[model samples]
Structures are given as C-alpha cells and as structure tokens.
Target: MKLWGGLSVLGLVYAALAFGIDQTFKWWMLHVFDIEARQPVALLPVFDLVLAWNKGVSYGWLSGDASQDLLIAMSLAIAAGLWIWLAKATHPMTAAAIGLIIGGALGNALDRAVYGAVADFFSFHIGSFSWYIFNLADVAIVAGVGLLVYESFTEGRAR
Candidate 1:
C-alpha cells in the first residue's frame, strides 16, 4: 500500500477501536459501576484498574470550562495537519507515528466535541501515589510520540 493509504488505514482502525473501547467503558462506568466503587483487577500489585473520569487532557488538565469547543478545534487542526504530513512520510515508521497521533487526537477531539470533556478511566496506582486516569487514546498518543522520537533519532544517525 502507499504510505498515506497505509497511515490512513491505521489511523482509522485505531480511531474506531479507541472510540468503541472508550465509549463502552464509559457507558459501563456510568451505568454499572458507581464512581467510587473500586473493583481492583490487579494487573500487578502496583497496577490496578480503577475507573475515573477526567474532564481535561491526559492527567487531567484544563478539564472543565466553557473552552471545550476551542479545545476541540485545536485538536482537529493538529490532527488534520498531521494527516497531511502522513501523506508525505516516506518511512513506514514515520507514517505509523503520524497515524497513531492522528487517531489519538481525533478520539479526544470527538469527546470534546460531543461531551465537552474527555472520558478518562484507567487508573494505575502504587500505594499513596497514582497516575492520572487515562484512556486508550492517551496511550496511543504517548506510544506514537515515542515512535516519532525514535524515528527522528534513527534518521538523524543515518544522515
């Protein structure tokens, strides 16, 4: 497949999956589980699945306000720009990174557009300390960023 086509496909797949998974969990959380009911499905002693809703971006910044529309616009702008770049990426890894970032941004953008807040539920904790509740989209963004950094460094080394 062509680079842009591949990236577009990947982005679409991730976006769909992210949307489906996030919405399902949110639906269950709102309907099935009370916000405070912690049913710890411990992946490890230090890591457990607890539901949380975040109003803002990853780690919960700028969550609540009238600025949700603005946030959605900015996210869409960024994702659209990245989609354009994905069309131009010569390397597979580069395309993949762009795909992931585009998908992730689109996922959150949808949330902001529809709900005025991103739904974040997935908390990892270690005793008194814990990470912010986040969703699959956030994971994709972070992974994409790591891949982009790796690609950049490798490309630099090659040149």
Candidate 2:
C-alpha cells in the first residue's frame, strides 16, 4: 500500500468543507447578522450567541497586544505540520481528523488576517457557571482532536 493508501483525497475534501462552513458562518455573523450589536442572544437555556473578538490563543491566553501577523504565522506553521501527517495517514478517520484541524486552523488564521482577531460567537453557560465563547472553527478543531484521541485508542487493537 502507498503511504496514504490513496486516501488523501478524503482528507482534502473534509478540509475544504470545514473551511468553507467556518468562513460562511463567520461572514454571515459579521456582515448580515452583525452579532456584535446583538450581543448575548440566548439560543437555549444553557447556550447563547455572542460576539467575542479573541486577540489571544485558546481561552484568551497569551493576549498582550501580540501582532495578528505573528498569530497567523503560528497557525500556518501548525497546519503545515498537520498536513504532513495527513499526507501519510492511512485510515479514513485519521485523514478526516487531520483535515478538520488544518481547515479550522486556516479558518482562524484568515480571521486574524482580515479581522485582526479570531471571531468567536457561541457561548455556553448555566447559571453563574460560564464557558469561554468560541466559533465554528473552534468546534471543528475540538472535534478533530476528539477523533484523533478516539482513533488512537481504537486503532491497532485486536478485534
């Protein structure tokens, strides 16, 4: 079998889809919906639609007037590494997961390049307990990580 087992196309497709969906949502939110003006709109008892311009890393870490260019460069670097892994991926699940990550990373990097910060919207909370605001790209990245962890546990095990 080839290094990727001729399955790289699956990953490329997933990456494209994830990136498209993420950008579409962000464009609608920023342009049509203007989510910043309509802040804290409750979608559910435990969830809300809000605008959060993250100038930092995950959970608002490393925020300190860092240049957007720097952050975007970092994202691209990480995505390049993931792309290498995807090129060698043999399993469909692994390929998809890596694609999701790369797509999400590129989406966020684009946001930084255009908006000067990552656009976050979803908010989950319960009473006084609140989670960090995030966007669809964040969702894709998290889902990708979950898939990787699950694949790690399941793959190469005797069936």
Highest TM-score, which number?
2
TM-score of each: 0.77, 0.93
How high is the CA lDDT of each candidate model?
A: 0.72, 0.88
Cα RMSD to native, each candidate? 3.6, 2.2
Q: Which pairs of residues clash in candidate 1, taking residues 3 or more apart in a chain or in different chains?
A: 55-63, 56-63
Who wins the lDDT comparison?
2
Angstrom error at residue 68, model 1: 1.0
Tell me the tens digit of each residue's lDDT in model 1 across 1-159. Answer: 233554566655655665566566666765677544665556787776665555666556676777687778888889878877777767778767776777778877777776667766676778899877777778878888899999989989999
Clashing pairs in 2: none
TM-score between candidate 2 and the true structure: 0.93
